[model samples]
Structures are given as structure tokens and as C-alpha cells.
Target: MKRIDVTRNWQGSRLDRFVRAHIPGTPFGVIQILLRKGLIYLNGERASGAARVKGGDVVSIDIAESDEASPPPATKPKRGPGKRAVKLPAAGAAAAARKKLRPAAVIGRDIRVLHEDDDVLVLDKPAGVVVQPGNRAERGSLLDSLEEYRRRSARTRPRGGAAAADAAPETIEEPPFPYTPVHRLDRDTSGTLVVAKTRPAARALARAFARRAVHKIYLAVVEGVPAEEE
Candidate 1:
């Protein structure tokens, strides 16, 4: 039995949907066949098509040796500033610099900050709030708020150091300003979210999740009653 640990990023989706997303290039009919053969298990129990998953559930599926061929690696985004203008402080004066470097305005009308620290920010995203901006016609998003957070964070740091000064003007670099997401909650599901302020922290959190070191609990309302244990 091949095992794969699920992450918080996979929460709120159906078991079938999650399987399809992770096992790329496999046909839907193949997945259905695996399910019928008792090859897929959710938390050590048989899973059905309709089973809804939470963040920490374990999903295991058996794959034949013919299917073990490796997929191509995903490409990383380009480095450098990408020609975008960095909002400069006014007049090159200290006071003017401080005033000009203020954080961007918060968007996403429904989002609220739950907790904040020098290394992270936690927000209670409302059910309908979108985390990132969409098409040109669409209005308000979480990315706007994150940009504001980044700007504010950048303004507070000293103007020295190789990584800090050499970092892309448009965005912060690793260690100090890595701009990473530790985990993500669904846009429609409102709950706690953890954002990493630095690259090392982000990597650490990712490893923790992969190792199943993080634990999560959820409250759900079901429509049926429990059967007695015989």
C-alpha cells in the first residue's frame, strides 16, 4: 500500500477531487478503478466518492509499477525585480521616507486580522473573501492586503546587509522577507491561517506538514445518527 500524507492545503475538497489533483496525468477512469479495488483509504478506512476531507487526513492509494514513472519537475518563477517600480520614499529625507513607506491599504472587505507578530500574520478570512486578486473586472482581494503587510514590514528594516539591500525592490528576498504561505484554508471555508514572514520559517513549516507533525481538529454538523457498536 502506497501512502501519501495530506496537507492543510488539501482541505475542504472531495476525496476523488484531491486524488485527481495530486496524481497528475492519470485518467479519471484509472482513479475509479483504483477506488473500486480497495486501493484508496482515508485515515485507514475505506473511502467513498462523496467523502469530504479535512486538512490532516491521510489518503493512501496503490499504484502499479507501470505507473511509477516520474513526472517532470515544476518550474520556478523568475528571479529579479521584473521591471516593476518600487515605491520610493519622498525627497530622500528620513521623515519623508518614513511617511512615504507606509503600508498599502487593506482590501477584501470581509477580512479581519486575528493575530500578528514580527514573523507572521494570522487573519480570519470571511467565507466569501478571495485570497488573491482575480480578473481585471473583479474587485477586492487578499493579495491586496498582503501587499500592504509586506510594505509595512519592509519599511521597518534597516537599509544595510547583502541580502536585505540586494533583494528585489518589488519584493523581499528569503530569510527576512520570503513571502511564503505556511498553509491555506479554502476561500469558502473561514478559519485560522498562518503566513510565514521568512523563507526558513516557511521551509520549516512545510517540512513539519510533510512529516505529519502538525495536528488539526474541526467541528462538523452531520445529518445522520450513529450506529451502536455490536
Candidate 2:
């Protein structure tokens, strides 16, 4: 611990500034270290670096012997003492790189809902939008839209985003409402679609599609051949 006498020379000066002026070779960061460690005191009480030093103020500092002998960190000599200015790379390159990471598309406003109930929602799939994210998917797909729609349509948010546990006495049940697509259409395909609003409903609809139980028909169909009564 080193104690420094505050004289008229340091009157009205900040503690950190006074320390730096009196101790020429010390780095400014060292004073911060002492202040943060509760090692700096003024008038026998802990003080911050920002405290003002008055005449006859006895400032005490806890510091190692090496601290006094240590040399100041070397600074790079300023380029011509003031003409130093670093050049930054062009903004276009950075913008292009950022663009690649952003979603390739935003959900369009044209999505039309055809049917909605407790367990399912049927929509008119707009063409040129993907049913799911792909290897190069940037803007996201139809699934992204459904997820966003569900969040917005929810009347209340459950605790921790989970369904409220208070609804059940024996066990806490997680909120189980999420919109999931039962099947996928091509990115550019437009048609009637079915979306499940609950996990059980999703599973049932998925199974129906998997087992070829659900029937789909496209009005004004194009680019397909009809079975010739085979």
C-alpha cells in the first residue's frame, strides 16, 4: 500500500488525473484496476477514480512494488503526429455478404386462408413460394409463414412460451398449439392445402397422406396426363 500526499498542486483535480500526473510512467488502466479492486481510498474511505482530490486530502492506494517500477506500455508513434487515418474496405462487399445470410424472401401478403377450425387450417398455396426450406433456402418457405401466423394468432403467450401448467392439476402441460403442414407442394406449385393446428391433428393428417387416404384435386389442372380408365 502506498500513500500519496495531496498538495495544492492537485486541488480540484480528479483522483485518476492526479495519480496519472504525479506518477508519470503508470498506465491509466492501472488506476482503474486499483479502483475496481477496492484498493483506492481517499480520507481513509474507499473512493472512485472520478472523486475530486482537495488539498490536505490523504489518498491511499494499494499497489504492488512492481507497479511503481513497471514501464508504461509502448504506444505506436502517431503517423506524422496527426495525419493518421485508416482506410476501410468498400461497403458493397460487406452488404453482399450480409445479403447472403439474410432470408431470401419475406412472407408475401397474398397468402389466402380457405378454412380454419380447432384442428386444421386449409389455405390456398400461392405459387413461387416454397413449402419448406431447401438446401439454398434464403427467404424461408411456406412452413415459415405458418409458424409466424400461429404466433400472431395466439390469444395469449404461455409462460416461458410453453403452454400454461396451471391448466392441469396432476401435471403441467405444455401449450400444444402449433401449425404444421401435413404435406409439401413444389416451390412453384399452387393448390389447395391442409395445415394442422395441433400436434395430434398434424400426426393424423400426415398419416392419412402417407397411407394415401386423403384425396387431392386440382381444378384447371395443367402439365399432367389423366389415367385413361386404367
Candidate 3:
């Protein structure tokens, strides 16, 4: 059996995602099956994959280290720095192949990145770019460029387990390119948009949008200008 302690970084995150984080390279379907079989528990009770976990909670998984289905590569976090590094699965040739197939509008495109942090990424999306993939769209999307940007960033940063132990133990490292668009602008509209780097941040931003707490302003370019009073 393996155990994990929930921290504030994981608060409000889906239980299934949390589990997947610990066990790298595990498929989502496998995680769901474990949850359904009651092999995974939260605070000693069987919990659904969608259950939200908060700080100070304990999660237990009833899988053997030596089992054929499970591997021993899972790193056990120690109480101090300089622990074993967590290995993120390498980006394979498939990713490169996909990038090659993307349109020029996406590949090597200059995205006007406004701001970025551990929680969110802000971008000034260009007018001709789509926010996400669609059946009818022919060109590339803002998200495709975002993924490429993330890949570049990942190359510069140290993997989570090593960095966390050496610098800030409390930091919960996000997966590479896990960013998701919280909201979107029309393809023809050019404006700033925010993308969530983590699930908790995504949920918070979603709530803010749902409650209309976020304010928006639009601008337009016209051929002629009218009187200020009119």
C-alpha cells in the first residue's frame, strides 16, 4: 500500500488527477478503475474520483509495488531535501510529429504573451487565431501555441520532485502543458485571455466567470469616427 498526504497545493483538485500526479504515466482509465474497485481511499474511506481533497487529508492506494500491473518507479517523498527525483515521461517523437503537421499560423507563430505564473498564463491572442481545436477550423489555435510555449518552459525548469525538495517543499508542481483555457474569445476578436495552469486555479476562475465577478471591456476600429456626444 502507498499513502500520500494532501497539501494546500492540491486543495480543490479532483481526486483522480491527484492520484495520476503521484503515479506518473498511468492512464486515466486505470485510475478510474481503481477508484471504482475501492482500491483507492480518501481519509480511509472509499471516495469517488471527482471528490475534492483538502489539506491534511490522507489518501491510500491498495496496490503492490512488485505487482505486474504496478511498478516500483513511484518516488516516495522523504521528510528532507535531496530526495529521489520524480521522472516525468519524456515527450516522444509523436509530439514532434504533431507539431510538424500544425499550420504555419501555429508553428513558430509569435504569440504576444502578457503574463505567466505558476497559477495562470495570460496572452494577447491574435485576431486570426482560434482559441481551441474545432472541426470547422482550418488554421492553428491559441492553445497549440500555448502548448509549444509550455514545452519550451518545461525545458528550462527542473522537474518538480528535485526542485521542490531543494527549494520549496510545499510547492505542488504542475504537469507539463497541463494548461487549459478557462474562457475564450471569438476567433475574430483580439484580446487578453487567461489560461489555468492547474485544476484548482481553473475551478476558481470558472466560478468567477459564472458569478460575473470578472469585468470585460471591448474596443473596435472603425473607418470613421462620430462626434463624442453622438
Highest lDDT: give the candidate number. Answer: 3
Q: Please report, in order, the local distance difference test score of every candidate based on alpha carbons.
A: 0.61, 0.67, 0.70
Pick out the ten consecutive residues of candidate 3 with the lowest summed lDDT.
85-94
Cα lDDT tens digits for candidate 1, 44-88: 998886687888788887666325433334344344654322221
Looking at model 3, the pairs that clash are none
User: What TM-score, to 2 decimals, does candidate 3 have?
Assistant: 0.44
Candidate 1 vs candidate 3: which has greater TM-score? 3
Error of 2 at 32 (Å): 82
- CA-only RMSD, every prediction: 14.3, 28.7, 19.8
lDDT of 2 by residue, 117-143 (tens): 567676667888887776655655777
The Cα error of candidate 2 at residue 180, in Å, is 1.1
Candidate closest to the true structure, highest TM-score: 3
For residue 40, model 2's alpha carbon misses the true position, in angstroms, by: 98
lDDT of 3 by residue, 70-156 (tens): 423534445356533322212232234335544422223555555555776666677877887786464467776777767877798
In model 1, the Cα lDDT at residue 184 comes to 70
Regions of model 2 farther than 4 Å from truth: 1-108, 135-137, 156-171, 175-177, 219-230
